[model samples]
Target: MNRSVVKRVVIGKPLKTRELGDQKINKLKALAILSSDALSSVAYGTEQILIVLAGIGFLAYWYSIPIAVGILVLLTALILSYRQIIYAYPKGGGAYIVSKKNLGENAGLIAGGSLLVDYILTVAVSISAGTDAITSAFPGLHGYNVPIACLLVLFITILNLRGITESASVLAYPVYLFVLALIILLGKGLWDVLNGQVPESLHTPIGTAVPGISLFLLLKAFSSGCSALTGVEAISNAVPSFKEPSAKNAVRTLTMMGIILAVLFSGITFLAFWYGISPKAEETVVSQIASTVFGRNFFYYFIQVTTALILVLAANTGFAAFPLLAVNLATDKYMPRIFTIRGDRLGYSNGIVTLGAASILLIILFEGHTEMLIPLYAVGVFIPFTLSQSGMIRKWAKEKPSGWQLKLSVNLVGALITFTVLIILFTTKFPQVWPVFVFLPIIVIIFHKINAHYNDVANQLRIEGAYRREKLKGNIVILPVAGITKVVENSLAYAETVGDTVIAVYVAFDRESEKKMEEKWNAYRPDIRLVTLHSQYRSLIRPLRRFIDVIEEKGEEHRNSVTVIVPQFITKKSWHNILHNQSSLLLKAHLLYRRNVIVTTVPYHLKK
Candidate 1:
């Protein structure tokens, strides 16, 4: 099969422009797709809290509920805050766009850098944690886990390249499955408590003390639990991906996501409290909770499997939003122009590939350790969250449309709250979060450089002076040909059209070859001078360049400028170009940088 045909098979047929409406998913599918990262965070969000609390022994476990409540309060305010964002910038005003427009370039770049790091870490940490879920169950295959995580990333990337809607379909079932399992566990545990059939595990003394709970410890636990908020911005960022009346659909998804995150996160924390589940070295808190609830039976395995599957698939959220963010950045010239090019599936193919490559590097660098990857997660997310919330405040105050005061107040609260959390996270996590600050400045500098390059290019390319019709510049066009073939004939034809004075130059390695070339040229008599030169060293570009210099040395009245019309022979297959030496490309590149010389390639595509 042809390569394109294979691609079509893998990604499905390309959708037409009008058919984009068909990709707008329903609310249930939207919830599963968009909310996966935030919802799946329950698997590790509670674990992260427990990890912090476990430092002071079992007594610290009680704080998990309170810390979770704090996180929940933030989640609710953030949900409402971002709902305003979705409506105001329904065209999908992610932090970068929102902040840049309202908060200025620096703030926007800050948000962009933060979101970029966060999305990449989302893929890395999500997959690593997902792999941990499996390894926690099996334990034997833990040694080969980094590679396993990378394979999972690759699988998701391929599915995303197929198109967002298709990726959502593939992701929906597993995500919903994970949700169902958790509900079953939470519901069953709650039922048992109400019916007065509480298990023995619930009496396992969660109040055991070492250092006990302290203010600093509670702050750390709260910050760890903020991982649940990592993907919250994704819905706002991807608002344009929603259906007709996009803002309405987006608000619906955002509300449902917020509610689901609250219920799952709250239930798990409560259940952990009820079951006396604490973090362990060998297994996770969720795993421990599952074992206690259902005694490690099939339902337990089902929960573990669904948990692993959803955690790995949580990367799908990054896969969806990162590319859309790239497209928006590219349109604003903060990124490369190539990022704007959509794939056959109406997706940003360049952005997807770049995201996948960046993710693979993160997975390898972190070596798939969830502990190493976790502390680095919150910083990236909160920066964007704060900046976006702050930007929303500006959006409301300036736009000040209907209900703008209330909207402004909500965003103000969200901004202050998220920013406070950010400050706490930075202070408590100064060591772990330092890399984010370092990497952020580096990325912001890159964005500046890209913007500078684009501006400089636009300045250079823009038509400055008044458009006056003048005779085209006087010129000598040189056609460099190897032999009297169709390619040469084509080049000469184009050269004649370009310049009044056209010359065909050929570099022959030996005198015999030079004589045969001159004889053949004379026999064809193409109404132009055929200049042939022999070389002892057989360096074609060097001799051809020297010949052009000799022509310029004349300083004749007609020799005002010179153009090198190089003939480019194109093979049918891209790989076929590798079979033959790229002499034409070499010659063109050779002439390209020379002062006062212009190069043009006349393509003669082969019919092979």
Candidate 2:
């Protein structure tokens, strides 16, 4: 099949530029697509807390309630701060744009690089967690988690490549399903407890109670649970993806997402405490809660299935936000310009593909183990949270818009809280997260290099004055050939039209072949001059390159320009072309950097 046909079938036909407006989604779909990450984090967030608390003893596990409350308060602060961001910078670069405009370019790059890394981890961690949910329900799939997580990444990447509206339509249901399933589980679990119908498993002894946990350990647990706040900034980053009145729509969606996330996170944590659930290697806290509340019946499976779907689909948030962030960086010349280009389906295909590939690499490296990837998660997330909030504080202070002091106070609280979380995460997660510290600076350096290169190229290409043309004294066309054939004849015919002088040069392995070529060329009645060069080591490119240098040196004497016409045979199939020697391509690449030399190809198509 033709490539275009394959692309059309895979991602649907290309949309007109005008259809970009049509691609904007309503708040409902935006909530599902953008909030999936924040919402799905509830699956693992409580477990992280429980695991930390469980480390000391089951008694410490109850500390999760206060920690959960702390996270909720922080989430509320972030929600309000990002809401202001959405309205203030409606074009929607989120942390990157806000940091750049208010804090400085370096701050922006750090914020951008941190978010980029976080988005990649979001996909990896979410998909791996999702796969964990799967294995929790069906133990048979445990060993296959890596492949499963990778396939989920690929599937979501394709969905986003199909376009925002289309992806939303497909992914929205599972998010809502997950929310509904969790609600049901919470409701039924609460009712059972209130009615004194608790499961027998709840009475089982966990361990001897330990009285104390260090402040550092408690902070570690708090930092781990902070994963719940991972995707809270995504709505602000993607305000433009909403329908008209995009900022308002994005703010509303952010509010809805905050409410849902708070309720689900708090409910799950509560049920885990009430049901005496702890994180098990084979099962998640959510899975334990569901099995306890609904038993291993239909409702139990429904909760597990929906949880798995939402966790996997939660990667959709990264898919939606990373590309838009990349476009912002590209617009500012910090990233490659290709990132600014939209795909046939009105999505940033390059960024989506890049994110998917990176996520797959991470999933494979961690072997789809969510716990291993989790330690690397919170640091990248909170760095941007702190920076974005800090940037917002600066913006409000400088501009002092209407109600600026209140906005400043809100963002100040957000910044201080997130920065405190960042310090805790760094101190606690140093062993696993140190690599992020190393990688963050490297990424920022790369951004600087790319921006510098673009700046240099723009300076070189910018035209400052009226056009001035240089007159060439002469034009010389040199045609390199392997043998005399129709391709050579056709190429020579065109070379004759281009310049008065056309030299057909051939590289021969032996004297006999050189004599035969010269005799054959004379017999063919070709008017062009044929220069025969012998290669002692049978190196074709070296000898040809030397001859081109000789010709270029002579041309310089006459102020002449040199053009090398390479004759290439076009095979009927692309695969067949690969079977033949690509010396012409190598030659063109070799001469591409010469200032006065031009290279061109004359292709003769094969019927076979």
For model 1, the run of ten residues with the poorest summed lDDT: 464-473
Model 2 lDDT at residue 248: 92
- Per-residue accuracy of model 2 over 345-401 as CA lDDT, tens digit each: 878888999999999998888788766667777777788888889999998888988
Displacement of residue 49 (Cα, Å) in model 2 is 0.6
Query: Which residue segments of model 1 deviate by more than 4 Å?
Result: 199-212, 465-599, 602-608
lDDT of each: 0.81, 0.85
TM-score of 2: 0.77
